[model samples]
Target: MTYWAAIARKSFQGGSTVEVPLPSSPKLIGASLLPPKHDPFYSQLFELEIQRHTTIAKRFDFHGSMIDQLMALVSSKSNVKNPTRVEVVTALLNRCIVNAAKKNNDPLRPFILFMPFTIQNLLNPLLPHKLVENYLTFFLVPIPDEGDLEIPTLVSNIQKEKINYFRKYKGININQTISTISNDTEDFKQNNLANTRLTTSLCGYQFYDMDFGFGKPEKVSIGAMLIKYSMVLFDSPCKGGIDVVITLEEEVMPNFEIDEELNTFTSLDPSY
Candidate 1:
């Protein structure tokens, strides 16, 4: 039987303690979900369409309003109104890593992203207590030496890698993978878990909008962690907007805050 069919059967039969659905199966390969195994990825807040950049180079600028303009470019270029947030970020981060490499003069400088997935409804009964947070460790593979590539190509490359990752690690024991990384430092290095960036998701999650028969929450947050180089993606309280929280080092914070490209689309005032 196919791996997904087996998972479904186990989920219904109560044969397994963790009923990871087919969708969540790929992420179940371990490494990204455990915080202790990897460094903390940062988060950032981008204001919506606060400004625009005229130059083409500024579109992918990490420090400028380019990030705000990025979605529009991707949407228009790909003809997709609501492209996947994780995919977009993955593409942007890939470019950022490459740009940072040139600035830092490191040819092999690679960036990794730790992304989370929601598996709340994977179980048969869909009990709240059974919910599990699964994640994937994505390596920002090096781009070719060719000239500037488009966003669609960027998105497609990462998507293809995801499929390849699943096929390669199919049927691996998730718990064993985690334990191996925790116990064997060499294994962790081989898995590239030590050098990955972190990202979290709250898409389609509306705790901020939950009325509970009372007024909506004035503020909602996951609370701040001292983690650096991590990012969290959330469905913004504002309609048709997304809120990002990026944490960076004190020295790097200044560069990102004053980034002309980023601030173009981001509001002047940031929450954090």
Candidate 2:
């Protein structure tokens, strides 16, 4: 059986989060660790805080009118000296955005954005042809003090490393080789619990959109059928809010097996 080779990756970029899900696989990993919530806006209102406690640079950007409105709540802290905490970091980015927004009066300071679910370019499978077993995508919020790079640039930076791993693995002759995600934090512990089944939470149409009732869907989410796996932030107009679908591989699968019964049925009626 050709099975998906799964692994975990994480970022202490700002918030605390441990991710599990190798890139070769069709979806993102689980969130075992979450960073401390700095903005009352993100956690207080939305009930979720994304990782990115501190970056080596100055600012990170979030897009769409939905994300923009949420950004407005994190007040600027450009001038705070000796800042190390996630909440403190929030101010610095906000300050930069405010000044940039006011200087050119551009309400939205566009950041490098990539919609991973849009695989139009990947129809031919742009990924390395080893049938990528598993992988994870980390949301990198570079320091505000740094210059901006487009989504393609960011994707290139990440893929370059993993593809190299796949190359070396085949060079040595392995059954579906794998890439080792750097152990930045302690969150990427190996969980080898095979016989685990996948479910909708890890694969398909989830609960993040039932309330919209056909109103442009709030955001166009990709599904598991054609897309296999997908994840995108569901931004809200209300302050201190952002929803993330950090799907863990194992959690979703086992449920699916149980729900479907794995094509197994005990013969209560015996044929003579």
Query: Best by TM-score, which number?
Result: 1
| RMSD (Å) per prediction | 13.1, 22.5
* Tens-place lDDT digits, model 1, residues 14-107: 6557554443333332234344433322111121111221111111112223444666677777645655655665565445434443444445
Error of 1 at 127 (Å): 8.3
Task: Provide backbone clash counts, one per model.
Answer: 24, 37
| Cα TM-score of candidate 1 | 0.52
Model 2 agreement with the true structure over 14-108: per-residue lDDT tens digits: 25453433344332221211112243321321222113111111111122332333223322322222222222222222233334334443343
- Poorest 10 consecutive residues by lDDT, candidate 1: 48-57
Give, for candidate 2, the lowest lDDT window spanning 10 residues. Answer: 52-61
Those runs of model 1 whose alpha carbons end farther than 4 Å from true positions after fitting are 1-69, 75-82, 93-108, 119-153, 163-194
- After TM-score superposition, what is the CA distance of residue 163 in candidate 2 from its true location, in Å? 4.4
lDDT scores for all predictions?
0.46, 0.26
> Which ranges in model 2 have alpha carbons more than 4 Å from their true place?
1-145, 148-159, 162-220, 223-272
| CA lDDT, candidate 2, residue 8 | 14
Report residue 208 deviation for candidate 1 (angstroms).
2.4
